[model samples]
Target chain A: MDTATKPQQIRLSTTPSRADLEALKIGDIVYLDGLIYTAREGVYKKVIEEGADLPLDLPAESAVNFHCSPAATVNPDGSFNMGAVTATASFRFSKWIGPWIERSGARIIIGKGGMTSKDYREHFVPNGAVYLTTVGYGTGALLGRGIKQVKAVHWNKELGLAQAMWVIEAANMGPFIVDGDLAGNSLFERENARIAANLDKVYEGTRPAVLRRFGETDDRTDEVIG
Target chain B: MIAIETIQETAERLMEKAAIEIPEDYLDGLRTMANTEDGDLSSFVLQAMLENYEAAKQDRRAMCGDTGCPRWYVKMGNEARIEGGPIALEAALRRATAKSTNEIPLRPNRVHPLWRTDHDNNVGIGAPEIEYGFEPDGEWIDLVTVHKGGLFGTDYRMLFPSDGVEGIKRFFLDSLVAFGKRGLACQPAIIGIGLGGSKDTCMVLGKRAACLRTVGSRNSDARIAAMEDEFKALGNSIGMGAMGFVGKSMVVDCNIEVGYCHTGGMQMSVHAFCLSSRRAVARIHGDGRVEYRTDPDWFTDYQRRESVEWTPPQSLSKSA
Candidate 1:
């Protein structure tokens, strides 16, 4: 690796401004500060589908929403024990992301395995939000250390620990890579294109399976996720 | 007789170790990849993972928040006896699983598939699957716990003998490319390939090959071992690295396991044990001695025996 080309790292607020996001390139490393909250399918379904009011102020409280399920537990005394924090795949949440961003006024969506550029163009670019991916698909323990405190957990009884909304105070919490940018450019798609250029040569001697499955694509450029 | 209390205690410790510690084999493998990896972003991700493991151990936290599904692989010597028997042994394992989930602060990942019920503990119906195997001699039981990330980077296919190894290679490449994009499979992982076996067993064999086997280990058969080397190289040549970046560190190692399947079918499954690659092992002797190690040392000669009638190896017979 070229040391000269080392990714530039920056720190930004959880409630980042439009300029803060616009200056971010697709591969810049980002560390976050201020408040962030966890929400996934359960929280999305609750607020967007079931028509329940959000338990807290949206972008006013925290513009960042983490697609995460921490290795956490609530003690008998009711305090939270958050050990490791990592993101789930963001592509799975495409259905509700646009609506959630619209409703919450989020500027940053952080998770693993970023959504497609189409997703970025449709949901995020219009909403003035960007996608940041957790490095290594995670650096859970490191991320855990960045969490200054667990401020609150909502709907633990109703949605369960993995699905509940967790409000947290963060201090330089990251190692996240900017996967989506203001222009809706995707780092992953760029990498995929580069990788796809060689698939033909690499796959030379092999033949497809004798049996075929429904909806399987032979196109190497296509993504498994929508 | 092996005490059930000892089994429970040992299991709990194994759980913590699996969650927090990066086994030496996997660590060494990753270090090698790190040294060779040249893609800037991919290299950075590898470096971050190296530090993550250290932080996990130093702070006594799980390496990955998605701690994967906790499972048990118990192997007993034919002569081994438990104080309270198999039923008691299972209860002990389950108790340890639930207790350690809370103690280690593991994400309670298991839930009811259909209704989406969460126990808040990893324990649920058939959650931490316990599989069994036996050796011909001795009075000791080996307990292995593997916390394998359950999603992505695994696939199965049915092919006929006519399709041959070429077909196998195609499926292998397809799986790697599909899941390797954006690092969904959590690449530069140990790739396990299972060829032959009934469909379900193919999946099991591939998973065990990924989770149970250590890096650099190869199949016992000479031909299969050769294929393992070829597959590892083939996967790396795909020009993808950690996080699906442009690089050549895709596969740390490839392990292939095979079983007899129906003559008409060649069932294949591919599994990738992610960057965390969490597995821990311990053996408990009847007289109360315990030893712990990272390598499960699964797939012994006896486990892969090809004959209908079992025969003790000459060395084993002489020792007996």
Candidate 2:
């Protein structure tokens, strides 16, 4: 219901005491203000699993990391020529959200494609963190517009520009939908159930109809998963 | 003979164009869909997508950041010889890709698998995936440059010949549903279904079909064309509206391309392109005359459905 309503603007930052992420409900569109760290698939493994010290200094608390491998070219000095920087698909990194939150004190993980239940309910619920979904394609570029400047970068040579970590100050940095919230709600899970129920009605007894149309008899049973 | 420099130059131009240019059909389709979609948010989202397109065009930036994998589909003429033969085309393409990396300022997407590696210019072993087809008795080279988003990477499977058309349809519908579940691919997605071929061949057709066919194009085979029509409605009905919002048109079209396969087995691959489907088409004559076209002409041979009334299924969100 909140998703269908107007979004509120909230500025979250490194100071965990300043804002209550838990107060944010699922589906509330929030304009994230201030510094948001950019990391991707490999950064989690490096920091959480592999125990590689964070290559760059980060906020100690209430930190937000976007799951993006930005297409940027860092200049010879340090400034980045921001190319089309978009969010990488979030499903693969869903497994790491919980650990990253635990290890890094990150209160928000911004990405595309809401995370699955494994992380959303199991880890995020207890951790007081949330997964925010943004437009996977264009908005990432738009977010680049809000980035006042790139403060620092890490592992540029090893991960290249895309996978590298860039600490950027983003002002009004998002029109992000709260797909997974600290309230134990998941927009994807809700949508999935509705669609599955509809599929049942649309294709009820589809196998038999298919067999008849193809002029084939059921000879064997084999498992098929989409 | 077509000079290698001409091929290289043409490839460079195509890569640059494909990154920044939204094909005419796609531009038209987005405007139409933006206007047709039911809600204000959906329309607003589509408008933002269009604005992003305009921003990319004016700023000379990539339409969407994904920039995807750099892929070129070449239809080489049998009679049109190259300066260093057909093998030289790959070299030309590679050179073009490097140049375009700086000019288009493409994202360096190519990375190492096992160890840490960055190709720096979006070039590595097997990068800039080039697939070729031979066209007999022609004097020109036709090239289609497509930039695919990372979301709908590629999915392929081998089904028994006994699986029948229904099985293929089920597989496609099921995949479409799963792909849209999280709205990662970015709807009004374009899907290409390739049926009946070896695994690799099916993937090639699937990618080409996904990239080349304009939204609303149909297959030549009546049965296949019907399948496409069914998919278009079924996909929209899933209620995965634009950017996973609540609206009807999740996908603009489903293009089906089929090829003959071994008697006992059928291989199918499904490839998807996101809403910002970026592609360009170009042709070079042996005499060095170059012509660029907006359409990929992939469906030139397919028999298109004349008129089909679309009846979208109930939106899943409405019931929710």
What is each candidate's DockQ, to 2 decimals?
0.87, 0.30
lDDT of 2 by residue, B93-192 (tens): 8888877875567777887777758877778888888877654346888888887876453577777667766667666755666566666557777888
Clashing pairs in 2: B220-B303
Mark the regions of model 1 whose C-alpha exceeds 4 Å error after superposition: B316-320
Best by lDDT: 1
Candidate 2: which stretches are off by over 4 Å?
A1-23, A55-57, A60-62, A76-78, A136-138, A208-226, B39-45, B151-153, B160-162, B299-320
lDDT digits (tens) for residues A81-193 of candidate 2: 77565677677776677777787777778877777756777877787778887764555456656667777777777667778787777777656777787777887666555
How far is each candidate from the true structure, as Cα RMSD in Å? 1.4, 8.0
Cα lDDT computed for each candidate against the true fold? 0.93, 0.70
TM-score of the A-chain for all models: 0.97, 0.80
Against the true structure, candidate 2 has what lDDT? 0.70
Error of 2 at A131 (Å): 1.5
The prediction achieving the highest TM-score against the true structure is 1
Give residue A158's error in model 1 in angstroms: 0.5
User: What's the TM-score of each model vs. the native?
Assistant: 0.98, 0.85
